[model samples]
Target: MSQIRKKWLETVLKYKFNHDKPGSPTIWSPDLEKISRERIKEIQSEKLSVAFDYLYEESQYYQEKFKQAKLKPQDIQSVEDLHKVPVTTKQEWLVNQTDNPPWGNFSPLSHKRWTTDGWMMFTTSGTTTVLPRVFRHTQHDLKMWAWLGARALWAMGVRPGDVVINCADYGPAVAFWCLHYAMSLVGCPVIPCGGMNVQRRAFFINTYKPTVLLCTPSYALYLGRTMHDLEYPTENSSIRIIITAGEPGPGIPSTKNRIEGLWGAKLHDDFGCTEVAMTPLGYTCEDEVNSVENPVNVHLMEDAYIPEVLNPDTLEPVREGERGILVVSNLFSEAQPILRYMMGDWTSITREPCACGRTHARALGGLHGRPDDMIKIQGLAFFPSTIEDSVRKDPELGDEFRVELSKVGDMDRVKIIVEPKSAIPKSSYIDPREKIQEKLKGLLGVDVQVELVPYGTLPRTQFKSKRVFDMREQCY
Candidate 1:
């Protein structure tokens, strides 16, 4: 290791995960984090004003949108008036981008601005058929990216001197860079393993022994077992913190336990998307609460985001602790401002302070499945996450598994195909097979046929693992 890396690791180990030990910048500032709920609103209101004005004045897209609605930027001064401005749908943004090639009119910054100041263009990794929704951010926005990410990292227990191995896929996708930037802001060494395959990435973990592994919860579990196949011990590795996002794994009880058990490390969950910003909307803390929801229950960084839980049908605000569709407005987004944008995610929010001692609003059960992710079978509706929680409780099953939704004859059917780990002998699949089927039926209220496939049979993606394969032909 270089002198700087050696000194950085030494300092991190010495400080014991505390970043504010004299000269380090406060990503999760104790003063800011512990501020009153009213004070957080005050800051959000102030920034919302700038975001509103910037989008209305500069972007022809927002100007046209406002003109059609006969709404003025001044009309929505505070977050209360945020409803007056209609929600900008993903289709509308895509149409705008299609009409105006490349970067699209969503960007308030001039074309010259891209050339003058360095800018980064990124898109969401959710879809494949449609043109990916792109976002433009200036060099100044890099600070926002770093700050937003580092704030969550601090809460998740990533320190200044730790070595972070990033396993999330790279390229135009915005996910990996945010974690990379956050690690930089905290003054840690981050290894980019997004390009490498699982085997190579496993080698790095065994050799360098990263203190933190950043990836989807599925990938973390995938790596842990893959390492074992290569005779590399992960439970004895240096990894202490595994911060995961991009999919619903860390929050699912069985899935969470599986990843934690395999790596012998704590898991942290985060929430975000490319359209709003490169940063996560919620941050999980290190506190281990007895409640299952508490570990995955994220603290909404209220200072930077205005989050609202709304009924998807009526668009009316829901009572605290009631599950509803999440609607969010960017408080500090300057380049591409999204106000009162429907997140389409199901969740509940409570303003109650967390055990971690922060006054920020907490996501009650983290992200409860998106509206479209809801699967209907024989008049019963359940999310893939619900099934995952059940499947993971079975120690015989590997993290690499698939949830196939298909139509068999006239009946809608759901089947779970799971890979048995090498540790489980072929002779002993009966107990686990029976147990997994029982768990799914008991937990999810739907009888799912569980098949135990051979050890390395299931597909794996380095990025968001596509677990749900909806094979129902379009009847529309």
Candidate 2:
């Protein structure tokens, strides 16, 4: 390795080891997690200085970006100067990868390091029209992932005696793999349910008697309902905690209550994207979950990450309590420590001390879906999560619903297809459908058609659920 790269890695690893407590049962790292706000900012400032210098020296993409912005590494020495740097978008990375093929220049991982010490490659789902964005990590990154993951999991009350059942497919996605290794570090035995179907997974929960279930919020609900269909009551299962990622769970009250009520387990939210896979950047703590707050908060790991909330329209910082999109700077990884990367989730943050005794900033109400997923119709804009909150609030509704959008002679039309629970008679669907429509109209300020389908009409997913289908001519 080059001298500059070696020095950068040594500096970051030193910070990681100084504050890490891998064996703690209550708090992962008291020195870091419970430190005063001033001390936290000092640590971030020092690391940000070194990280920017390394990125400027090694990463060609960042070098070009700095040149265009008329700034140098020294210009961004503290959190106060973060606005001088341009915010990075996913589309920019996609274009760079398209021009460069396979891996892009955004990351500092060179071919030599990748071949010698590469750990794994993770990619986006690529469900949209664009190609999937890929990321490669080194062996050094695996250690960071394990340490940070262990801290977040430990805060969520995962102990040595707990048996975790990971239900996500062991694909190129980063969440499950990171949690798997972290569980090993935490001394918890994990049941890898990657290749199993929902029915088989439900069976494993019954036969193996795992204590913790890990999957998306959608899959958790689907699995729990399927267990009911197979006569395996989830409420009676051994699972005590359900750790969910890949979708909004604890943020939506109706969805959170439904999952917790169905499985008789506490639902914890783990938030992060493929680009920021070093750890669960946002997580729920024991106190946050047990609090009487209607919508529980997710704490951001500020020591390992710097989160900034920017207005979606102006790309400027909003007031502390105001809602805006999230942009993060990863200060803890080896392979892909991206700076000012736009995560695009809509939320607000506060630096007030949490009841859990952590001084890090918490994302209020968790993340409420991304701005890219927001839908507009008839001069009104709203997110699919709003629709989800309305649909899931109705007790007669099943676990599946979809928002279908089409054009009706120069006018936009939205139709919500929802399934009634099997116990509800077909004749009784009329009341529930009308109720859902009324609630949606009140929430969105626009009229929408509601269609009631049979119990098994809509399909269920073992991964992240796709709830929107836009069939407008403009979409084509």
Q: Model 1, stretches more than 4 Å misplaced?
A: 1-27, 126-128, 288-295, 474-476
Candidate No. with top TM-score: 2
Shift in Å, residue 130, candidate 2: 3.5
Which ranges of candidate 2 are over 4 A from the true structure?
17-24, 426-430, 474-476
lDDT of 1 by residue, 1-476 (tens): 33422332243223222333312333366655777978777766656665666667777888788888898756666666777777776777778888998878877778777778756878776554355777778886676677777878877878877999988766887767888987888779988886788999999999998899989877887788889889998788889888888887656777777777788888887787777745878767777323455336777877667888888889989999998888888765557667777777888888888777788898876786776778787888778787777666666666677888788777777788987767867776555767777878877777788887787888777777778888878421
Instruction: Give Cα distance to truth, residue 230, candidate 2, Å.
Output: 1.1
lDDT of 2 at 1: 69
RMSD, each candidate, Å?
7.1, 1.6
lDDT for model 1 comes to: 0.75
Model 2 pairs in collision: none
Per-model clash counts, in order, read 0, 0
Model 1: which residue pairs collide? none
lDDT string, candidate 2, 1-476, tens digits: 67767777777776775234553457888788988999999888877777887888888898999989999767888888878888888888888888888798988888988999999999888765467888999888898888888888888898889999999899999888889998988889999998988989999999999999999999988899889989997887899999998899988898899999999999998899888645799999998887768589999998888999999899999999999999999987777878999989989999999988889999998998887788988888888888888888888888789999999787888999998878777775556777888888889987789998778889888788898999997754
